[model samples]
Target: MNLSVSLASGEPIYQQIKEQIKRQILSGELREGELLPSIRHLAADLNISVITTKRAYDELEQEGLVASVAGKGTFVTEKNKEAIREVKLRQLEEQVRSLAAESRMLGLSKQDVIGLFDLFFGEGRH
Candidate 1:
């Protein structure tokens, strides 16, 4: 697992690490059943505190993305494609809801937001 913590980012370092690792897992870059580096090793690699790495791993475990075995190490959990898709869909929906709220706060109509989305994504499709 590769992670680069952005100290300049407003997000907590552990959250940044957790998000990157989660993205890797979702993208299939980090295969299921693959062992992740030890928390100490990962902390040293990222030049962060062990507590930060532990927090990231704890969140992953809570999300069922990784499992830890006593005396062994943390490993990615095997997930069905449908299950992964559902998880991703839920996450996306939450983000979309937040964005919609922000748009509403900015006085953007639903149609205007849809148009902006189409313009932004449609351009990339072609």
Candidate 2:
């Protein structure tokens, strides 16, 4: 999986790494059982400390999104994929619900919301 860390962002590097990896898994870009880069290697690649990458992986494991073997490296857990999917789906629904509430408060019509979605979701600048 491709990953990058932004030094300019106020968020912690470990959190940025964790969130991106989670997004990739939830979006089906990172398949189940896929092997992730070693923590040291990932830290080197991102120019961050090994502790940061390790923290990110540890958090993922704690959430049951990834598994680590004694002699092997970290890999995505097939068994927990569905659970992760459900969690991600619920998070997305909550975000959409919040947006809908805000739109209503702003007096935006359904068509206005649809237009905003189309404008942002459609093919354009990446």
Candidate 3:
């Protein structure tokens, strides 16, 4: 599990860890049943406290993104596609909201925004 935290990002280290792991799971980089690195190992590798790492893992577990075994370790759970889709959709919606606000401030019309969106995606550009 490759992860990093930036002290300057203004987010808590545990939240950073949780978000990174969630991204990996959602992106399918970490498959279901794949064992995560031990908490102690991850803490050592990241130079973070074991408590921080455990908190991240615990949140992920509570969110149904992972499961912890008593004798083994944490493992990614079978992802719920609807849940994943909802997450991505919410992010996109927020982006659109910001775009709409900025567009209105710039005196751009709805058609103008649509044209730009079409121009970008219609040309196969991400």
Candidate 4:
């Protein structure tokens, strides 16, 4: 698994790590039952505190994306498929809502937004 933390981002580092891992899982880049790097190892690799990595992993476990096995390590959970899909869809909807609000605040009409979207995405569609 590959992850990059943006120290420049105002969001907390742990949150950045969590979101990136979640995105990877949702994108199928990380499969069910995949073993995650140990918290200490990941911390070392990222040059961050172990506690921070542990917090991210803990939140992931709470979200059912990963589970820990005694004496072994944490592995991506199979049951996260549906939950992850729901989470991603909700996140996308929230982003669209924010963008729509911003467009309105900027005095852009609905048609303007639609036109921009089409200009960017139309060629990719069949």
Candidate 4 segments whose C-alpha is farther than 4 A from its true place: 111-126
User: In terms of TM-score, which candidate is strongest?
Assistant: 3
Local distance difference test values of all predictions, in order = 0.92, 0.91, 0.93, 0.92
Ordered from best to worst TM-score, the candidate numbers read 3, 4, 2, 1
The best candidate in terms of lDDT: 3
lDDT of 4 at 5: 91
lDDT of 4 by residue, 20-65 (tens): 9988888889999999999999999999999999999999999999
Per-residue error for 48 in candidate 2, Å, reads 0.2
Model 1 poorest 10 in a row by lDDT? 117-126
Q: Against the true structure, what is each candidate's TM-score?
A: 0.76, 0.77, 0.86, 0.83
lDDT of 3 by residue, 63-112 (tens): 88999999999999888888778878987999999999999999999999
Clashing pairs in 2: none
What is the Cα-based lDDT of residue 104 in candidate 2?
99
How does residue 68 of candidate 2 score in lDDT? 97
TM-score of 2: 0.77
TM-score of candidate 3 against the unseen true structure: 0.86
Our tally of clashes for model 3 stands at: 0
The better-scoring model by TM-score among 2 and 4 is 4
Query: Least lDDT summed over 10 consecutive residues: which range in candidate 2?
Result: 79-88
